[model samples]
Target: MSEVIIRDDLEAMAESGLLSDYNRRRLTAARPTDGAMLALNINLTAICNLGCTYCFAKGGDYGRITGKLNEGADVESILQFVKQNAARGETVRFEFFGGEPMINFSTIEALCWRSEALGAEQGIRFLYRISTNLTMRLTERELELFARFRFTVSVSIDGSEATHDRNRPNKAGRGSFRAILDNCYKVRERSDDITLVARMTYVPHPDSSLVADVEALYAFNIFDWFQILPATVSRELVRTVFADAFGDLAYSEICRLCADKVDSEYKLLGEIYMLLFRPGNRFRGVLEIETVIRMLLEGEVANGHCSGGRNYFTFSPDHSIMPCHRLVGEAEFRVGAFGGTIDGEAVAPWRLGINDTPVCRDCAIRYICGGGCKQENFVATADINRPDPEKCRFQFRLVHCAIQAIAESDAAFRARRRGVLRDLFVSCGRPTLSSGRSEEVPAPDRLTHLIPLLHAFD
Candidate 1:
């Protein structure tokens, strides 16, 4: 067994001020960023087959009436939107999203084919991505299309069979875990080219074990990557659970409780340590950890929490445009509409760099943490510019782990693993280097600053 980083180690580092010093240096070195638009998130449908209790989308319609994209009219408008927004000769990604995107399979099919033709004509290269529950059956044609386009398929399966079934059941109240697992096998069998990512939502329940859940998913040996997110309960559910409290108070209380539970339950540092150093382990990289690792390895600083309104925009079924997918139903976040002008003023705040925010300005890990998620910040603090303290604590811990992982790993291990990460980034068409220059892995001696703060995993 590999050495694990315990909570005491983190506490020790904090007490010694090593973490603070490191963050200060990083923050001082941070640069301003103005992100370019590169991807379009198309909400194919606001309908899902599964009835997840904690769905942010309110059972797929974002609390509105259910609807899907119009294959003809909507497709054409989206293509036009892409042509207008995307630069010529640029490689842009079209992300298919929904309550269950496959519900509008024909729309997705039409969009892909038409977008390819449009891309060819306009000198813009197109990439494809989809986030699905994977409960619906896929046809051979669909599989072939995905393989041909080299689609990045994000499968939403909430870890263990019992946990997943309990959280995400079909409308008919039947478990969908078996169906999803079978479909995963079929997807893998169909093509090795398609990037399969297991996206797990960790709901803090008595039966749910974060470590065991991750282990169960890894046991499958099918996913190329894993993305684990803590469940954010819907406002309606929070109201129901806290019947006495009125609107805003209920929301605030729930956010606080959820954040506290997530922080307590997510033993990220130890989990990452084990995954990286565990001997003979079938460890598929977790997206969150890998992102921080990449940032550390490349000495990259984040411009913002995410591209969102700056470089990324989500198109709704009714032609509404949102800065972030999570902000789909929010009227305040509606930047513009398709076939209309995008409000530059509305997007300007989201475009601000991490250091630009007053709350994040003095933060040590502002450059690395990206000020946390804007929508999450808004949900917690009612201000996009202000970050939630609980989330900040979580991000700080994650960054600390990444630093230790890098500082402790031997040169040979890092070199071997570097290529794996590089290939993953390249496959996704994301920038391998945030500095926009040659990436140089800092020598062990150069990382001596962090070495003392980190416990060796041997």
Candidate 2:
């Protein structure tokens, strides 16, 4: 078994900007994001077959608040919107979202077919992504089309059979893991879709085992890309919806769970990377620590948490627009309608970066976190500017772990680390670096206040 390795030289790396570069680049990416509207989300339908207990959209069970799109008018309007934006030479990205996007397969197909032809004719490039539960039976034709279009499909499945079944059961209260796995096999057989990402939502409980859960997820081997999200629950709605699933844990406890889970995973992967000399392992979780590694490796920085209401936004079934699909029907978030005139000014408040927020500006991890998630903040504190203390602290611990993993390695590995940091410095337009070492930033202590863990394999 591998053990956690803490390095004494962590503060030196933090000072030289090698450790701090991750957050600095993230903050830089968040600000002055170049280009207009790079990505757009199309919520195909408000219906889902598998009713996940942690679903924010409530499985789209509600009525017209989950609007039904008029196929003819809605598809046309969405295409026009894309064409208008694509004219500016930006490679437009369209994300098909859901209650299970496959439920509205016809709409997705039509939109893709038309958009592909239009993009080809107009000399505008396009990329398509879809988020699905992978429970709906997929046809060979659908797989073929997805492969041909090169869709970056994201399948939602939590950890193992028992864990997944408990939270993401179908309407009949049966586990959907087997069915999803079978479908995934089919998807693999049909095509080599390069970007297959597995999205896991970590709903922490007293019984939760972060190690076991990740081990279960990695067993399949079908997914090389992964992202784990901590469940964001509203306090008022917790009593009505998440009481049984989450137990009596507070939001801070949930954040602590997320922090520990991330630390464990990072250490596990770091051990693997160190043993094999494989830097590719660093890309395992693109949306989490892996993203920081990638940004450093490839020399990229990003603005705040999300580009919602900024360079990208979501389009609901009825053409209503919001910052992102996660905030679909939120009243405060609904900036305008796609078919109608959208008030750009209404979205300006949401586009505020880390520099704009008074609380975030003073945070050590502000640049690294890009002010955290606006939707999560809004749900937790009823204010997007109010940073979640738990998440903020979690980021500090993660960065600390990542820095230690790199800084404490042997002298031979320093060459590889220097190459990545040198590229990062150049990419962000910073002065070329002589080496990766920098002035020391104090290493945050391991989060000892974490909730107790049950034996993972038990």
Candidate 3:
């Protein structure tokens, strides 16, 4: 198991302004659902070129709907929905999704332009994002659009060739690792400012460990940000639907592996940045703990994981709407349909906050955790309204590991060992000064130049 140094002085550190109210408030205040719809995920198509074993959508599988799209009225309705939400003074983000989103590139190009024009006229900011397998070659025009629009692209690739190709293969059953890596390089070459996040779905193969998987991502060298999700498949679903591919890999088994190795994962992350020359890029495997500490410092409580229907919703290619991208397929989960009326009754159940969940009401760390992910709840309990015990343990472990990091960082900063604090805070995009100023310290480049003497301590 990985180890994170835990200090018992978090309360004292908070009192000493090691945690600033200004920074904490600034973070928690930017809640996705402050007033209106925060994000809309538009699935342009269900047909992906690569067939990943853990795909929640079952992209190429015949059992699920694929290659569907919104026609004239449905398209108009989606646009109107965004415009209406933006009119309410909310900054709305539109995410492009797919079996592979690039498969429907033409539609995405058109939609991006349309959204930008609307945002310009209405004084609304439009943020664009895409989650793709990155197997196709990107055109010059596509790269130019990404640069011009400041797109945040999340490329889904598992770590290492053997591990990645075993789970994620193209329709022809060949490895996609090479093409995806090449595309990532092309993206970096095209734009330096664009945020490239590498998202990995970890499968507990008999030969690999989580630490090794994370190291594989770092070896790629292009991704500045990373998101890691354990491959989650319900026991019944695996047996009935994807028996050949997933076999007996259960979500609980995955959770147990992670819980046992939490400390090992923590230590790896603490030392990970030392392996690279650059100081800016970050791995977010358990990065949410920083946010949890910020929320704790501010003395605030939050709803469960996501506000779902209230803050964000997914508009599928067929014009059906669900709470999020993860809940795309089930008919019972559909809350509304574009070009049609929204059923408030259907959405009401989803809007239930973390406070509404019975189990979470008494939990000590509910403020940081919210409840658990809604999709995982549905998978474990067979009821979207219920919380999953397996996922609860996983979420709790993340919060616990995060608390450990905060304690260590704060203790080190007060002891004049700000170098370690600087490294940890670099991932947060800004460093909290031990000098107790409400304002943030300067950028890493500016601070690094001023701190040549600090390296003597190192």
Which candidate leads the pack in TM-score? Answer: 1
Greater-lDDT candidate between 1 and 3:
1
* Model 2 agreement with the true structure over 1-458: per-residue lDDT tens digits: 12332233333333433443444443444434342336777788888898677678877633345655556778898888776655745567777877777888878888888888888788777777788888888888789878988877778888899988877899888999999988877776777753566778776655676557666767666675565666665454455434565567785665565566555554554454444334544234324544444333333334556666665667787668877677777676787787665577877776676666878877754544557677677765778878767666656655554444444556454333333222111111112111111123222344221101000000
Q: List the residue pairs that clash in candidate 3.
A: 1-264, 2-263, 2-264, 3-263, 48-99, 304-370, 304-371
Q: Model 2: runs farther than 4 Å from truth? A: 1-32, 35-37, 61-64, 236-286, 297-299, 404-458
Q: Each model's RMSD to truth, in Å? A: 6.1, 8.3, 8.2
Task: Tell me the TM-score of each prediction against the true structure.
Answer: 0.82, 0.77, 0.76
Model 1: lDDT equals 0.70
Tens digits of lDDT, candidate 1, 1-458: 11234454554555554344333344345432232336778898888888876788877888863578888988898888888877787767788898789888888899889999998898988878898999988789779988988888889998899888877888888989999999898888888888888888887663357777777877877887877777766566654323343445655665776666676666553445645445454455677766677666654556566767766788998678998887787787789987886798988887665545788877866666767788878877888989878778878767665665666667754554543443232212222225421222222332325442232110
The runs of at least 3 residues in candidate 3 whose Cα sits more than 4 Å from the true structure, single-residue gaps closed, are 1-37, 60-62, 70-72, 236-290, 297-300, 410-458
Count of clashing pairs, candidate 2: 12
Per candidate, the number of residue pairs that clash is: 0, 12, 7
Report the number of the highest-lDDT candidate: 1
TM-score, structure 2 vs. true: 0.77
Q: Per-residue lDDT of 236-334 in model 3, one digit per residue for the tens?
A: 344422334434556566446544454345445544422432455443333344444443332333433665766677888666888767778778878
- Between prediction 2 and prediction 3, which has the larger TM-score? 2
The best-first sequence of candidates by TM-score reads: 1, 2, 3
